[model samples]
Target: MAAPLAKEQILDTAEEVLRRFGLEKASVVDVARALGVSHGTLYRHFPSKSALREAVGERWLKRVSIPLAEIVKESGSSMEKLQKWFQTLIHTKRSKAIEDPELFSMYNALAEESVEGITAHINELIQQLTEIIEEGIRKNEFKRSDAGQVAAGIFYGTARFHHPALAKEWTSPNIDEEFRLVWNLLLSGLKF
Candidate 1:
């Protein structure tokens, strides 16, 4: 007979593996060995390494996604929504996942490579921002412009939308102040 792993324990082990070695090294055998669990035990819950990685990605979204949606939804204006999103990005930048330079670099590589649905993630962000901008345009609050281009510009400010660790230190101010300044300038250019 064998002991069972608590779901949390499995997830924690998976995250730790990803943090240290990233996707390539975060193999099933690696995670199982790291947790001192048998391969059979890990396979019982996660059929494969991709399955475990997906779970971790899902956890990452759970930690950051809803709050992001809420702030954008509740904002009094689209510009405010944009600003709030940037602020939230900063807070998430401090997350353990993002704090690890190697992990972050791995993410950057993935984003550029479109690995792990990385392009899908960026497309989602662009779509969300486009919707907000469209709403603002409808309300006569924003000048007519290409939402995709605007989204790309914001990406520039955030280091192609990578966040604090990925950005040049001189390219952006400290998070909150930097976001406020970014919104200030952006609004001036965007307002009707």
Candidate 2:
């Protein structure tokens, strides 16, 4: 007999179904059908279609956060870590958009409908930023300030480089230069 499907397997197939059919057309039935199972079985894993979409969004956002979180823990000057963190974030988002335009579009649509998951993802990213800022302050690399607030400022201030809404602009030749200018300005504010 085939092994019982796992939650990850369901999410994986759901993502494929989303990619194949796009967000508006994709449904729990589609995911189940793709997995060769009944919708009821998929429903056991995700109580509703909205819940499944949110879970998929959460999973995708986690992929983005995991690398940033590693940068936060690395043994380095916070300045280096901070720069690397944002660079990784921008690269990840841009590559995902470039590598799979359909999947990228689906994620943006899901993000719009999955506010709770998106908010949680944002909070997790902010918390990661907060840890890096706190370390910098502790090391005297950054001026004394509220780490959480500064982290939020950094995140929002650099939004154009990483935000999904601005994905199209990421392909512009000037995008890297623009990010460098913003990064330098934010760095100046953080340093003594």
Candidate 3:
């Protein structure tokens, strides 16, 4: 008999199944079949199809957030860290959209279905941005302002480059130049 499937393994298989079948048609049974397990076995780990889908969405969001969190902890001036953070965020989103369009679509669909998970993911990102802004304030690198508000502004300000809904536009030749213009504008506002 095969070893009992780990939850992470189930999530991994489910992601693959979703990629193959697309979100609307990919059922819990599909993931179970992919894993060579009975659907009931997956139920032991994920409870329901919705629960499993939520876990997959949460996992995908974490893949993006975890790396950004590391950038937050790294040693750098606030300005440098903030630039790197945004660059990384744009690159991550762009690559996923360009390289794996189907999977990227699946992720967007999962995001729609998992509102609470998406909210938490957005909150975590804003909190990371807030930390960077607070550091800039402490070091006198940025003007004194509400860090959370500034963070949210910076996030929404750059949404054109990073937002999933705008993924198709990311492939434009001028997207990077446009981002630089926006970044410079935001930087001017942040500086003392």
> Can you give the lDDT of residue 21 in candidate 3?
86
What is each predicted model's overall lDDT from 0 to 1?
Answer: 0.66, 0.92, 0.93
- Per-residue lDDT value at 100 in model 2: 88
Q: Where is model 3 more than 4 Å wrong at Cα?
A: none
Q: List the candidates' TM-scores in order.
A: 0.65, 0.96, 0.96
Alpha-carbon RMSD of each model: 4.4, 1.1, 1.1
Per-residue lDDT of model 1, residues 39-156, tens digit only? 7888889787666676666555445556666665675777778767766765665554445656655544434443445545656666666777777787778888887787767666
Alpha-carbon shift of residue 157 in model 2 (angstroms)? 0.5
* Local accuracy of candidate 3 as per-residue lDDT tens digits, 66-126: 9999999998799999999999999998999999998898898887788888889989999
Return the number of clashes found in candidate 2.
Answer: 0
lDDT, candidate 1, residue 121? 60
Residue 131 miss distance in model 3 (angstroms): 0.4
Residue 148 displacement (Å), model 1: 4.3
Steric clashes per prediction:
0, 0, 0
Flag clash pairs in model 1. none
